[model samples]
Target: MYRERPAAVITGAVLWASEAGPDAPPTRVLPDGCLDLLWSSRAGLLVAGPDRRAHLSRSAAGERWRGVRLPPGVGPAVFGVPADELRDRRVPLDALWGRAAATLAERLGPSPTATALAAVAADRLAAGGGPDPLAVRVAALLAAGATITATAAEVGLGPRALHRRSQALFGYGPKTLARILRLRRALALAHGGVGLAEVAVRAGYADQAHLTRDVRDLAGVPPTVLLAR
Candidate 1:
């Protein structure tokens, strides 16, 4: 089973995936500039960092996993690590948090479910001073295909300042973020059964060739393969 929902105390979402059959294939997790605190039935708590490309993960049949996905720019504040260091990485929570990780592990107890994991994330966010509204705005603007210069002006940040913040928050510059966001937009449209050419235009790509290149770059596959499952 797989299910997801908006989180109550945070700006992102929570999701859980469990084995459906004995021969279930590994799942492909796409990049979306978010970080996750995951609790696995076999592995306890782990941190799944932001990705620049898709990740393939497998679980034994009947094994369950729960995760709290934090909004971009919010994980560093809660975990006390730079986004750049964690990019494309998954590490044991204890590695980053030591005693705090152990305490949280105990609080989550055995067989931690998604709701319990979300509670732990909520507590951590409260302790870390909560989510930054500006980061949310920056993400929204970028996802909407706004130019970095225009986004900076709207957010009242200079170009250099925005670049620095983007690095810390997204582990990349605005241009890279825009590319990722555009890829996501195109994929969403494709999933909705839109033609590839129309998807490119709607997702702000220059053409179908541009969309295909980006899909291959970020997803490690062409759009057709990615959308086929």
Candidate 2:
């Protein structure tokens, strides 16, 4: 079974999952413009990089895993690496942090649980400094449906400056982040049983067709198919 919840000390969402039995691993993963730090019983510690499209993850049956999903503009600071380098990749934490990753893993001990993982993340963020204020503001404005130009102006940055910062922080520019966030909004509404047409309107899409196109582009599946999963 899979489960997710809002994290208290962490800046973004938390998710944990375990296989019910000897079943095949689930295959679909949609882009959410976020980076995930994952710990698995089999894989140990791995950092799942920001994805621009749906990805397929394979694991053994009955495997268990936990993750901290860091939001846009926050990961680069928390992970201590440029977002650009990690984009569209799943890398072992040891590769990036070397001994530090080993030390953190040692702190986690064997078969680390979600609470332990969160504690490690909290300690790192506390030491590394919190997220950049400008990046946070930019994320909020774009998520709230502001235009790219407007968000840049509000953040007191020019278009190129905003793009550069966004690339460093989000692994993509603001325009792509806006699209991903809108798809996320629509998916949330759909999960809450909202009709597709209303989801499109409320998510700021021009129409249902627009919503469908965006969903397919990002998720590699139609809204109905994606939601059904």
Candidate 3:
């Protein structure tokens, strides 16, 4: 069983919980330009970093998990590290927060709730003075399908400067973020019953084949397989 809701204390953050069924298979978690603070019944507290490709997660049968999903650009402030440093990795919270993480884990106990995780993230984020406005703007522009040049101009940064900042903010350059967001858009459209050809065009792909290739590259599956799930 799984459920999620928007976190009341943090903008664009989600609080989620899940229990792995006895027969559950490894789950494929697609890249979504986010970071997560997670607590597991068996693993204690951990940080789930941004991903450039899909991540396959295996869990013990009946394990319970709770997490606070932080939107792009919001994690660095909360985690006190550049997003790139933790990309494609899941590390124990103690590695980053040391004794503090251990303290938080004790507070969470064995059956941590998503609400508790959200409160912790909110408190840390507030102390960090919040996410960078420029990084947030960059993610918005790219997700909205703006060209990289246009996004940089709107943000008043040069291309090189923008790329450098993006690496720290999003764990990748703007071009990669744009591609991931576009793939997400395409999936949304396809799931809504839109035809593949139209979904490709609407999502900025050149054609259905282009969309298929991008989906396979980033998600490790073709569009048809993803949609079936």
Candidate 4:
């Protein structure tokens, strides 16, 4: 059977592998069928998988681990987003990877230099689309709206124009981005052995089934499947 080899589920908060060093065996984070965001403090960090079905490798102990894989045609990239904004909504992974990502990702690496990546991340975190007046105002309107039209009106743009900006920078539309944020929230709650039911409640879903479906659609696996690993 096709099974994930070498990879071991270390703990609730982080996925770990038991090799002598962090470089014992590499862990390939095959896209977890979700916008999985991870941060690790290890040497030779072999992480290249984008927000989608990403793969990672770490050669430490005599072991190797290939993380869960994603299905076909996953959209968006979701890395380096703020811890607080994780539950924003169903946004595109790639859309979030602009100048903002450059800053946050800098922190993840061992550059040993004072990089501006964090500052960029800070700007986006505090103002998402804000740094830009139009972007910020529009995003704010979207935030207060119950529908897309309301959000557009608040931002002073037509559907087409808003669509372009969202696609260019955020990878997903405002509503979709919102869903990505929601997924992050669900993921955090579901991190440990939290039941799907609880995850749904904590993430503001209708129920466990809803949560499971939501994750499955984005991550390609049911909630149980994700947490089980």
**lDDT scores in order:** 0.83, 0.84, 0.93, 0.43
Instruction: Provide the lDDT at 169 for model 3.
Output: 90
lDDT of 1 by residue, 95-155 (tens): 9999988987887688787777777777777887876677788999999889989999999
> Model 2 compared with the native: what TM-score?
0.95
Q: Between candidates 2 and 4, which one is better according to TM-score?
A: 2
TM-score, every prediction: 0.93, 0.95, 0.98, 0.43
True lDDT of residue 41, candidate 4: 33
* Candidate 2: residue pairs that collide: none
| lDDT tens per residue, model 4, 22-115 | 3344333333213223222333212223243223444444432222221111112113433124322333334556564455446545432112
Provide backbone clash counts, one per model.
0, 0, 0, 50
Model 2, C-alpha of 134: deviation from truth (Å): 1.7
What ranges in model 1 sit over 4 Å off?
none
Once fitted onto the true fold, the runs of candidate 2 whose alpha carbons sit more than 4 angstroms away are none
Specify the poorest-scoring 10-residue window by lDDT in model 1: 11-20
Name the best candidate (by TM-score).
Answer: 3
Q: Report the lDDT of model 2 for residue 203.
A: 92
Which stretches of model 4 miss by more than 4 angstroms? 1-110, 113-130, 134-146, 189-195, 198-207
lDDT of predicted model 4: 0.43
Where's the lowest-lDDT run of ten residues in candidate 4?
A: 69-78
